[model samples]
Target chain A: MSDQVTPSPGKRRIGVYVCHCGGNISDYVDVDRVIDAVKDEADVVVARDAMFTCSDVTQEEIAKDIREQGLDGLVVASCSPKLHTTTFRGVARRGGLNPYQYTQANIREQCSWAHTDDREGATGKAISLVRAAVARTRLSEPLEPLVVETTGRAVVVGGGVAGMRAAIGLADMGLGVFLVEREAELGGWVGDLPKMFPNGTDGHELARRLQDEIHRRPAINVFTRAEVVEKTGTYGNYQVTVRAGGEQIRLDVGQVIVATGFASYEPEPGEFGYGAPGVVTLADFTRMLDEAGSPLVYHGRPVKTIAYIYCVGSRNETHPYCSRYCCSAAVHASLLVTAADPGVRQYHLYRDMRTYGRHELEYIESRRRGSVYMKFADDEPPLVTSDDGSLRVTVRDLLTGGDQLAIGPDLVVLVTGMVPRDNAELTTALKLPVGLDGFFNEIHPKLRPVETVVDGVSICGACQGPKTVAESVASGLAAAAQAAAVLKRGVAELDPQVTFVHPEACTGCGQCVGACPYSAISLVERGPAKVASIDAAACKGCGGCVPSCPEDAIDLAGYTDAQIRSMIDSLLVGSET
Target chain B: MTPVPAHAGTGRGPRAPHGGGPRVLVFSTNGISDPGIDLAGSSHMHYPTEVVVISLPCTSGVKPSWILHALERGFDGVFIAADGEECAYLQDCSERSAGIVERAQELMEAHGIDGRRLRMAAICSVCAEPFTRQVRAFAGSLAGLAEVAA
Candidate 1:
């Protein structure tokens, strides 16, 4: 850690650099004019324009100025701070200035690139941006990252295929794992499935293989009929309590992986003739087909013709998203049915065929095997009815110019989609955010897919959203990798930008307590007074508590009220074209 | 107006512009809306050069006075890029921000400032095009208000 020399407010020596970005900024914003305008700003000791501020030569020059001029603060007028904040912060550190005393002016993204038609306007804006940055920097102080020690352990929730795989992965990495399952056994929905797609592997067999691997690892401790009821403490040092059997078991772990999987959407009774004589869910029908002894029978009658209803519980009002696995599941089932009896007629009534990726091949093969697919309009869903001893499905076939057709079939299968498992208790325990779609929300779907807003916690598998077996397992490994990355070093550093409390100013009004989402703030008795205290590790630094304090007791560090007012003054005072 | 006791540091960028059109001061969140607006610039999307932004930790952290202060300090408009449901910290950030906007609007009205000059909307991390579209639309409305007054 670099030593931080506190610079007094009036004596703050700051270096300001305007970057050309090789005309990325200079072409639109006159860099020399920006430097000229901000050269005489308060606390600014050195101001200059650079062809490339991030270049090694310019960096050395800035470092030399920081050392020779004894600069304590820095303002770099360059591209987005997102791109080069760290580079110049390192420059500040090497120059004996605290890194937090540095700030960046996003001239490229906010000014130059945004105003290509007006160079004079861009230059004036760049000048103001630099001055504001200098103003913010004048109040900037050194900040040290909050480092939390880890327990070298992880808790995997769900006990599904994803959870099992994640447990095995964590165990292999030499981390102790607590694999918790709400059920009596390991395998989740996959265990109940007869077969899965692509490899055509028995779903139960895949679950068994993962369970065996987990059992073989002594580091993995399985807790069946157990669930994490509460999670406390900060990242890399979490204390979780699992409700298992008839007792509460507490464990200290570094990370938690939510591979909670998902539940299949069940239709309401009488919807799509769901409770009819011959109608059954696709899950029930598939199991029947697997154990049908070469002849599919429903209600003591051999099934001659079968009609499959796709999207019965999905693509509708209740469930809007398509269950990504059902199309392949149904197609794979049809191939199984064709192998059993080529004489049996199979009809697929549905909307658009979304058997994406390799599953599309399964769709074509199912078609070549004489499985007729009928397109149905979204508004006009197919209807299923039961009579004396028969089942019939009526549908408007859009492919046949929207012709309505009705036929009786021995068996009717309702193709259901995946739904989020009822995890209100666990969701509350972990404080995981469920999306508007009721699925676990991640930070970013593509960039940081597995991690959640809660530090040391990540979501994976169908619980995040519907996914094929392969995709589920892929996300499972990603969550394991995320947990490992944070816990491997046995220490994790949280951003120091998190909230802090001013004890003397705090009236103990408790308004800030409710405003804090992480529950990091609490009112504590200090002598005869109650004051708000902030736990730095738990605070995410969203600043939601700042304005909620009527006493103005709570304020952010770098974005303090004084700095903002100064920046505002710098922008408006005698500032015009 | 006092020293930050021995505690954590807050990180943010404060940006202001000088140009034509209504100078809009947007209080954008660091984690959510700032990146979205940056995406607009990287995509070479153009808006009025006068739309300056002061990045905040969260929109809920913005005091109502900050909004009124920007307008009182010669800014024609004050926009808040709230962290809606995509907020990483609080679940009710948008609601809190809405309350701030309401109070700020009431304050603006008391000061005889046009309430239409202030606005608040959710700006997600990936809402780049939406951010640009919002700035352009807000700038247009502020310009219209100026014309009507003239």
Candidate 2:
């Protein structure tokens, strides 16, 4: 395999390889028929079928053909490009041809698998797809991938459990970390909790342990009362501006991790008699339990009876999502209260119980301790009426077939859910998508859970969605690993298909500059008129600016206007042979 | 399984000297719609083979001249698979591509080509079933138009 190829002007030597995919494609569509149909297509130097073209041995064979057949262009009729596009491109590169000169046709997904019942039609479509690739290949030119330098530092937004854990993970990977916390304290909401569910671990102690770990790391830079005001540049080299302690500081980092934890749902005043005496939120109750020693006392009075109202502001018309962790938290809180005062009786008025995972043990314990649990319908909520320094809570228990149960207790704790933090400023600055639920939306919920659509930026913890402490920590580690992967190579290879400006054709009207989402285009003076110049590193190859350019000056490298037009012509109109 | 359409020939169609099926050109965005098309194939969802795909980086990158050129060169219908908000390239790609399509439709009317022959849809990377359904519907509409023209 050599990297040198001399092509005769106006002539394209193309090789076509059809993969059988081990009968994944062959059983449905006739592979040899496709090869035979496209073999005599104009400029097709060779056509063949393989059991599995993606195999290492077959790739080597294709490379061997590239050298011996003098094929200037190649096409692989196989699986989706998402699967093995880079694989075949590597083969093309080894064959001494420019990787960009190769085109991949989806014969498996778009033809063979799709029209399995119609083999003849599928084969015909495969031939046409290959023909389209060949036509496009004739117009493709060899291009090199753009290599961009990377910074070894990572900027982590929010100093919650996720941020702290991510910072530690990055530091462990030998990368410098800038951990930014909006509040003066490093620990987020986790620092305020009295006791965590399942394991009776002190939330503050857990947060402090993480904070101590971060403090001990030499590579970690802690910034309290800080916020990332602005962020610019691409994946490998990002300039972030942090406003901390009344001064602005700039940091250049390779990646960014968003761990801005969620905000606890705050119930409105008079909501379920929330502002009344003896009526406290679950968060307030947790702090009260922490402050008041072994025997829980509210206002110097020993609390003997307590009623916990579940789903205060969640799973309603206003907030449609279940705060996932609230049910388990409620159970844990009931158990804590039971442990504090063995004589105290607890009644929990709730919706559907969702004590999932290991938290089920705590739920069982709460039930074993004789804490009364009642289910209430969504439409008919429990009514809390205050009369003569005592609370009267009447709920139609769905479990007992609409039997109205009334409980009068000394104290009422509203079990509130987690709400998304108001990250409007940060969201605008980062240009990240916020879902209709007001949480940061990951690119894909399952596949790329921690990764945002933006390159080099990751979202985890409560910011992405409501997550438990353990899940938050796991997401933090995942984000840290993602960031480390970006900086691990010390250099990033951007897509070679980024947009470029034709200086001669550029009118310098600045339309492309405004149209560019990444600010990759800028106007520069050329002779008398200014022509737009593209910063290839900053350009994400979105081609948004291409249509904005009135003079047709801007075009992406791989999907050039001519190449795309040729492909369209090939599909709609046959090749002008 | 539905019977395969008669116009699966290698030659360009509808107006091809050897008349057969309606030739529909599908311009799919590489990042989103192209993968969706692949998923459609992987899912074994069938649409007409007359619909040939031309993968572009984004539908915003498509020039109106290319659509007009395809129409002039014996193509029947053109489908632009625009990536909505999920576009990796630009935030306002849907609106921008819609503007391009609208302009192309106006140009098609001026060129004596039926503006209805041009269709634009926002197909995400995961919308394989929707893509096949859209293509099948578009192909059906084009086939009806071809019968009327004949």
Candidate 3:
């Protein structure tokens, strides 16, 4: 026990603060008992319990104690660090102690909340948790965050509405923007849509206006028919190579925004009489509407009665997620036809009417124009048959309680949902994760919406998920704000909890090179042996390569072997005293 | 100061047998498993407080020696909450962590400890209910083992 209590260089005065959380933790775990249990532990000079430790008054009280007692370290037995780690760290910093010297013991989540019925056990575990924090902080060393300069440039991928908006937003902030589009035209899916909802704005005209604005900006560089060939470097310094017009162009930027738009779902042949004469997809019908005159005509015939099938190639075995735009699109299409020719009959076959938000007005208007809507079940989808040079649709209506409805129309339009673009090549080059539905996954859908797991890159638009045009544009602006915030300060602070290599123990086996997922580790010549060198800017601090080293030569700065061993020992043995 | 225990059947140390009940050490990753555990707590799901959690940067950073050290230090079992596919560290995080657990089990068996004393499970960030159920089941299994030994 004496050997476990290693003497520190300074006066090892420590303070511990436990929060009641207004009986959220107090009712389950005895807070006063915990304070009494750890007050006499090794170097604990001051131990107290608070009603709410995160409150500003309580934080000030903690700061006052730190200054009056001359404390060197602190252990806050409170909620998970995920919520208040930074808040308490700031308390420590204001208390004239290094923020890194503090440790947050998760008593609320792992102890009081997990063991509500066992107060004695929760108190005992809280003591153990605080003891582990004390043990870890006794060996904790003050660390300074790393600061890197920003290049004041950004790379915007996929020049759709989202990408165009992001480029415009970034350029408006006086940052050089490089907008890359894989297609020759910049509008993407929006360029093909005839008009948008709510006010009947032309989609192509909106995209053309954005393109004109982008072309007029001097700081924005537009690259049509271009693709990102390679991306290297870390946050604040990224070298992006783009292949365009049979030439390779390299751009040095600080941040990247991936707004690669979505692809419309294509139905299989004979799935919905798709190969028949007048059967067309919603995209195809919209294109025809854009080209046709007032009276809608298809296949050189005046279209009178039309049948629209919703959720085609979506909400099925192959595609389980709702495309989120199909129901509204179908309703809008029905309204378009009803407005063109009031005498024409329009029938909408859907599993559910999800005409959400203001689009419900269009749904109401479509119904007022004498359009018929029939709901179907998942198991009994609408079946289309082409016989005798005519198309017939059979669907079991769930609304009418298992009644079957039949409709034969001049044209059948399949309301296909949005599918993720084939981002296999881009996903590999960017090293981003794609969800099971094939869309790019964000770190946290609500908290870190546009940000990817990668440090410097972010994702927005339909690439992340099925988004409406307004939602995609909002996501684009949000990503632009995030990027601008990153570069606005002209410097970024990196967490000091990165990997470090000890030259004396390294065998130069080169095993860590393959173990590193971020390719942050490299071998550098040191004396006669080549030791591992980690790029602090590029390292994600995952600590994967730490265990891969056969000689145990590598260790993370904050999570060292000694620190973890001490924590484990403290968890089992309690306090050394 | 007290001498360290030789093995499970050898002798008693400070933590060799305590009235505090069975102690389980949990090694949870900071990214995925730790958050899941927190969610379990935030949801007010109750479990045994005998479990103590230590946050790691990644489960791949766990050393076999550390597992053996916890077992020898008086912990009845060690539960490694791995990150699995959601590991921001590596794509093959589960496979790599399973490799470590395999080696640790071999070391445990060689040292006269039951290989089942150590367990590994993948807990993602949103796996709150699954995590509570897993911990409850694991604790029950350990309790059953203790009864058998008695």
Best by DockQ: 3
Runs in model 1 deviating more than 4 A are A1-10, A48-69, A84-88, A116-120, A315-322, A571-577, B1-18
DockQ of 2: 0.37
lDDT of 3 at A507: 81
| Candidate 3 off by > 4 Å | A1-11, A316-318, A360-371, A574-577, B1-22, B118-121
- Fnat values, candidates in order: 0.56, 0.53, 0.56
Q: Candidate 2's residue-wise lDDT over B5-113, tens digit each?
A: 3332212354431124677788888767888888888777877767777777777878786787677666678888877766654566778998889878877777677
Ranking of all predicted structures according to lDDT, beginning with the best and ending with the worst: 3, 1, 2
Tens-digit lDDT track for model 2 on A1-577? Answer: 1122233434789988888899988887777767766677778877888889999898998999999989999999898887888898899999999999999988888777887787666666676677778887888888887788899999999998899999999999999999999998988988988878888899999999998998799899999989999998777899999998789899999999999989888999889998888888888888888788868888888888899999999987777888899899889988888887888999999888889988888888888999989999888888888987788889999889999989888899999988899998998888776765778878666667888757778999999878999999999999999889879889977767788989988778899898876767889889989999988777767677887777888888877778876676555433222
RMSD to the true structure for each prediction, in A, is 5.4, 5.5, 4.0
lDDT (tens digit, per residue) of candidate 1 on A527-573: 99899999988887777788888888877877887788878766654
How does each model score on TM-score? 0.90, 0.85, 0.90
Better of 1 and 2 by DockQ: 1
Lowest lDDT 10-residue stretch of candidate 3 chain A = A1-10
lDDT of each: 0.83, 0.82, 0.84
